[model samples]
Target: MAPKHQPLRTALIGLSSTAATSWASRAHLPNLLTEQGRSKFTITALQNSSVEAAQAAIKHYNLPPDTKAYGTPEDLANDPDIDVVICNTRVDKHFETVLPSIRAGKDVFIEWPIAQDLAHADELVEAARKSGSRVGIGLQRRWLPPVLKLKELIQGGSLGKVLTADVSFYNGEEDPTVLPEKLFYFTEKRYGGNPIVILGGHSLDYIFSVLGNLVPESISSQMQIRRPEVKLVDPATGKTIKTVTRDTPDILHFTARLQPSQYVVPGASFHYVFRSGQPFPGTPTANFTITLESGQIQLTAGSPPGLEFAGPGQEAKIKVWRRGSKEAEDVEWKWENVNDEIGPIAAAMQVPLYAFADGKEKGDGWVDIEDAREIARLIDGFYKKWEQDGGL
Candidate 1:
């Protein structure tokens, strides 16, 4: 581990400037360049598809010239000076990219939907266990301000006993006939970055963030491949590049019965509905609410729904309406501690860095490897159920 005063020597893999939906650029780098982020960590190296690609990224990202560049995960893992590695590659690329780092006994953080499925996610979990390297997942939703405030309110008994939770998130798909060329694999089950796991998983993660007592003991599901054919288009341009099969779920619905908890009475239920290929019509992209014994709480996204993606100027508004109140009062919430320039989304990525630098294994919104495995495993069960239902 790096010393308390010294920054953690860090390495970033898959930090591409041209990739489709570059989360590495949007949700990660900005925070690492901040004053506090710099004090806590330093970029020692990078691992890209090739050595030349890594060098290109170094220049693109404006890191120090002395930064070493590697083409392979093993080569990056072999660098003893690199204390931590952050992987932001595609979901299918995650297992191969981070396994070496875990075996090398270096700390790691990988973006959500940890792997292709439960099998790969489990393998990473076991590797981290054997190597004893602390691992964190990009389940940064719990740290978002709206989620944090909801957590405080629910857990503090501000809403009384929780009875039921209902969540609805719509991708608001911009084009019904087109998908991004690079994202073709995202709609395939084989690649494991489909709407089911990415949107469904994050929805569950955020809801559980505020309502931990509602952890599903059992789930019943219904899913359908609503869009079987889609035009693969250039993201920057609307022109069609190709047409591909969209075999993944465009509509997913689930009902869960939670295990008993102090804050929730028995028979409490959670219902989730996700729809792709359709945009919300002048309404909050997400409409979520919790029904409590004495009152209720509601959350809606000003931007697109889900804590998995956050951009500048986006907001999640929380409102509370008690039994005695005439109307719901808005709950004022904001991420005050972080620099406003970085915004809440990218700033959430730094929470684990500081935790790891301080030698702690856990902190708010930090989902460890095992926690990540469970989410993947749970979502895997959804697929099995879908299969059992003949991919309805």
Candidate 2:
């Protein structure tokens, strides 16, 4: 790893925008500044459409007073001291906002979906390629602890000949009219829809990162929007409202074929289900489960410490069972604090950078423009298929 003191100087552009404000101000920026964060990087500049908002954010976060605040993304991108450009703009504005930085040969770390559509994402990737820039998309789940453990067990052959795989998630999507404006694109056909294109995209990325070589042979799905009366209220004024319409699918359920080999038995099948906005009364709040040919591994979270604002009783558990045995054994992992399992999450965040840094040290890096393009292709293809399915 590079010397901690020689950290990268990063200029954050467009964070004051509503789309990036909460997550950037609360999670991304703080993580970048703390010791547990990228000790080698500092937020050298803050760019926003509104200088006042940026000023308030900087003060709220207790960032260095000298951190330059700009009224536009271009201003921050052009700063000579900025070695990296962090793009946290809205889902639709990423390409436009980050392209200039790429043209200027600055490394970029942006949130997922890269853009509302693949072409825009590809345009940014092409610019990055021409400029020899590094691009890192925020698919942080790949760096989460439970996932790492699952990867180890699967790769180590602990779950010999892995069999069927299933993934499911319920993200609130029922009331379209009452939905927040910021989240409305999530349901608009123009923007990537529910789990399939959005969550499913991340899920597939993680799946491929760990499982390797799993591809979609066929996808059949049905989609619906339960709530259309939802309205988006202005954050500052609860009285103001905007009603929008969305044609995006709220539910995505599909099945895929996993190559039959020593990993499992022949004809291994994978199933995935994603739903939006459903109440979980007696069920576990959040769960990521990996059921193997031999047994199953489950990660569960409750209340204060879990990711997302889930209700109480958060815990992480692992269960194992030998093939052909009815009995199963379970083990529990440690939590770093009462508010978050962030210790493990924070540690996991370093893997990508470590991989990239190691590659850089060896005159090679794992993250590049091409990888971003490939991810874009995957996102594009998934949506195309969804559309062809008659919004199923």
Candidate 3:
């Protein structure tokens, strides 16, 4: 009800002061403060666990003086002036945090892992469908410059038909051996933000989304926890706080045949290995090798290796090796004009939010609740396959 075509009045959920819990503030605030963000939406309100928390966040973010604050999802969702609600709560809290907003017919954007599990994600999908609310999932890695460039190259036949892909990603930064006190929840599968979901899920989502929307035909997977316990550390002092039994898989290796599609060659085999701890010595954090009939393309980075965001300096570059070429060529890729403070991650995130705000763009890269459900299915499939093989 804020006049048609005018900037949407938006409410932010889970924008806290702590860096560990406030991913929304870290990745979103920059883009939301940009010229494009300002033109498309306004931060009209905030909701945290308590009214004081919400008010503190609003003050900390330096949002407008009149920005409203609410302590609960229901209160925030019921605000008639709010046109959009963006939730950046923990993975396990996703369902409850955004359900009321979606049901209230408020456009909602949720961080990935859309919900704790596929069942919850399915319900949210159905709810969004019934409510006819635009729900954006934070599966924004596909919008990264390198990803789009790969898509362009593939569709344009720069790499010929992709016959197979081998993705070996080692999440070195957030290793399985240790967790900061703040991130200890990640060691448990119950939290739903384990390596399989964070590293494997997001990476696979981007990889397949760029590769002609390929779906897994038949997947065989193995999961193992190399570490029995993970040491919890005081993030500030790097001192060990305590240890908890590791309930999450540290090594996940899966091989699958992708269903034939317009882009991928028939019988395309996709092999993925997502390791929880440090990368093998002298190796990149993540290595994605796409084998095409004519040449090969590999994207290696020391960041998440998932290519969600860039690593330090030239570590995030992609190299293209044609069959006849002496060596691979470094492909040039860059993001559009973004605020300097936003960095590559937020800049990548801006695409989906902009698409949502404009309400014009559509397709595979535009991740909605339905697409989130699909990704959740993909995530669930891996676990099912792992269970079928029996736990390690």
Alpha-carbon lDDT, every model:
0.80, 0.60, 0.80
- TM-score-better candidate, 1 vs 2: 1
> Which lDDT tens digits does candidate 2 get at residues 306-332?
233343354445566666778777654
Q: What are the per-residue Cα lDDT tens digits for candidate 1 across 1-392? A: 43444588899998976677788987788877888878878988989999999999999988999999999999999998988899999999999999999999998999888998888889999999999888888877767777778878878886677899898888767765577787888668899997768877877776776777345557788888877888998768778988887768788888887665777878889888888755456676687898998899998874555653545544677889999899999999876656666766677666655666666646544778787677788788878888998886
lDDT of 2 at 256: 68
Please state the error at residue 254 of candidate 3 in Å. 0.9
User: Compared to the true structure, candidate 1 yields what TM-score?
Assistant: 0.94
- Against the correct fold, how does model 3 do in TM-score? 0.94
Measured with C-alpha atoms, the lDDT of residue 217 in candidate 1 is: 53
Minimal lDDT window, size 10, model 3: 306-315
Candidate 3: residue 154 Cα off by (Å): 1.2
Q: What are the per-residue Cα lDDT tens digits for candidate 3 across 1-392?
A: 12237488989889987547656866788878887778888999999889999889888889888999899888987889999898998889888889998998888888888888898888888888898887888888887888888888888876678899998888776556778898887887778887778767788888887665545557777888788788999988999999898767788887887767767888898888988777877678888888999999888887775464555553467889999999989988877744467777677788888777777444534688786677789778777766777756
Mark the 10 consecutive residues where model 2 has the least summed lDDT: 357-366
lDDT of 3 at 223: 86
